[model samples]
Target: MRIAIVGGGISGLVAAYRLRTRLGADADIVVLDRAERLGGILYTGDVGGEPLDLGAEAFVGRRPEVPALLGELGLTDQLVTPAGRRPLVWAGGAAHPLPPRTLMGIPSDAETMRGLVDDDTLDRIAAEPDRALTWYPDGDQDVYSLVADRFGAQVAERSVDPLLGGVYAGSSRSIGVRAALPGLAAALDAGAPSLTHAVAAALPPPSDAPVFGGIRDGYRVLLDALADAAAARFVTATPATRLARASRGWVLDPLGLVDAVVLATPAPVTARLLRYVAPKAADAAAGIELSSSVVVALSLPQDTALPDNSGILVATGESLRAKAFTLSSRKWPHLAERETALVRASFGKFGDEAALSWSDADLIAAATEDLATVTGAVIDPVEAIVQRWPGGLAQYAVGHVDRIAEIESATAELDGIELAGAYLHGVGVPACVASGETAARRIAESLSAPAKS
Candidate 1:
């Protein structure tokens, strides 16, 4: 069997690796990436002698797949936790620590909310006289509005929206939290009562495994490891322009060719290829618009006095240096220089595209200025690094899941066709890996299914 994997990002790489693990070269595999690089969003750069994460900075503990996979790959020693005390919810000129006993940002006791909580909002949420709940009445609802309705518009506007943009690099108005946060969504639907109470019962206990870990060297280490383990050959810089169906299976040309192709690129690119194969599916795929974001890393002076392990998230109306900044040195000291502080700040989400339009020097200056106001730090950065990812984040709109299911079902009739990437399942790195693994498993199992009887 000859399998062609499209898009050499994390998803494609993982699928190829997993196929090799299960099939042991029973099939010929090749990975094609348009860019000359791997680890699409796992980019890391060196700024002023310090390693900086240009893409995602940290992984949450609740997601165990990442840590477990790292351990399996012999990367146990690379685990590093952000030194920040706790992520803050910045809103209405105040930054409030997430109340204790809350799960998934849902406060167990709404009355305990500080600073930004309002009596009217609390009354609206707590009043259950005319309350009615069902299995998420609508399968398609914006996650932002749901949070705003249940947790107060302040929480949604200040905390949830920015965090979603931070995590997904997209707009929250179109995201469906139920799919993004399935566990919490399920608990809510199960009648745990109140977003706060439901969340407590929803999340499971923590794991002994490091919640999150990257290679001590960097994300490239993991990508390189998987590349070496895959049976698929990799062709970098060979962009597949079009994918046409063949009488035998499928001929992927400069466009795409192969028995089956696993597209792991961004949603828009994926849609373009899928259009010729399945038009309806292409529309669904294209609907998931990707958002662009920019990350700026600054190295502060040695004399800078900063809170130890404290990272701050700016409220919506906060100074517009950028959306948020993480005290890199304080959060992950292992990656920082002792004499100087390192900070990673992000600017540019849906409506904030103009933020990245500025020159690197100006953007860094702006970011530093914002940090000065939030942290009261008075020092110029020694070195600065800025990275921009265009259309990298996937937006999950209403009926997204159904559209995906339909796509999967639509492509099944066409043998040697498989879809694997963040757009299909979850969008996080761990989930990306899982999505790849699952797609590969499906491909492998069908191959061994006794010729479909």
Candidate 2:
């Protein structure tokens, strides 16, 4: 079978890799990417003679998918957990440690958040049990609204926004609960008495395993491993412009006929390709909004006394332009072994594009200023790299799950085609990997099944 996997991001690459494994030597598989390189946003750059991840740095350790994949690829020894786990939040002109035992910024114990919130807000949160139970209506609701309605606007702004923004580069008011925090959503849907109670009930017991893990060298190693294992034909700087139903299977523009195609591209790109064959699916894909963001990585002098904390998340309404700052050196000890202190500052969120509009110099300056305020240490970055990801994050808005369902239904009518990416399911590396593997297996099954004779 001739198969073409589009996008060449982690999802596409993983899909291609899995397809090769499932179909073995008989499969004619080609991976196509618009860029000259694969790995998409999983980019690593050299800073001060050390490799640093400019894009995603780590994956959640709780998800077995990535770890299992690493084992299979002989990369089990490369996994390294963070040296420090506690991350602070910059709010009220100061940095405060994030409260413990919280489910995605929702504190399990109100008293633990005393330093983060005022007494009045704490009192309101303490009274969560007394508040009237209001079940979410059918369909979807924004995370901010749900949290704010249950636990005051201050909690939503200070806690929920920062955590969600850090993950999706999206606002809590815009991201859907069902899509973004499925566990919390499920607990709520089950009619849990209160937000606190629901979160506590939904959260698993704390474990000794680190929440996140990264590669010892860099994510680049993982990408390189996948590429070597897949051994598929790679077509760089070429994107699947169009998809047409051919007499045999499908024809990808300029790529000729393929028995199957997997779209691992971003939503907008996928939507355009599917417009002709599956218009409804394309429309649904188009509805998925994206957010642009910028990451400024700075290599400070070795003498810089960075905080022991892994990073600092800037709460909404904080007097800082940078959304969050990661003490890369401290978080990843491997980087700390180098003679320089590495830090990464994130700017821009779903609705905020002002930072992205700034020049690289301006953005770096702004990030430096914010970092100084949060860390209380003067920073003189000897080397700096600014990466601008336009439409880097997909905003899973209300009714997103339903819309995805509809998209899948429409696309299912068309044979030998599948959609897979961070846009579908969660945006984490594990989620994307699972999505890719699932797509590959589905395609394999479809091809192996007896045709409608």
Q: Candidate 2 lDDT, tens digit per residue, 324-432?
A: 9999888887888988899999998988878888998998899888888888899889988999888888888988999899889999978789999999998889999
Candidate 1 local lDDT, 128-226, one digit each (tens): 223554446345566667666666676566556666766666555767766667777677767665665666677667555544444455676677777
The TM-scores, one per candidate, come to 0.89, 0.98
C-alpha local distance difference test of each model = 0.71, 0.88
| The best candidate in terms of lDDT | 2
Question: Pairing residues by index, what is the TM-score of model 1?
Answer: 0.89
For every model in order, what is the number of clashing pairs?
11, 0
Which whole-number lDDT from 0 to 100 does residue 16 have in model 2?
88
Q: CA lDDT of 240 in candidate 2?
A: 78
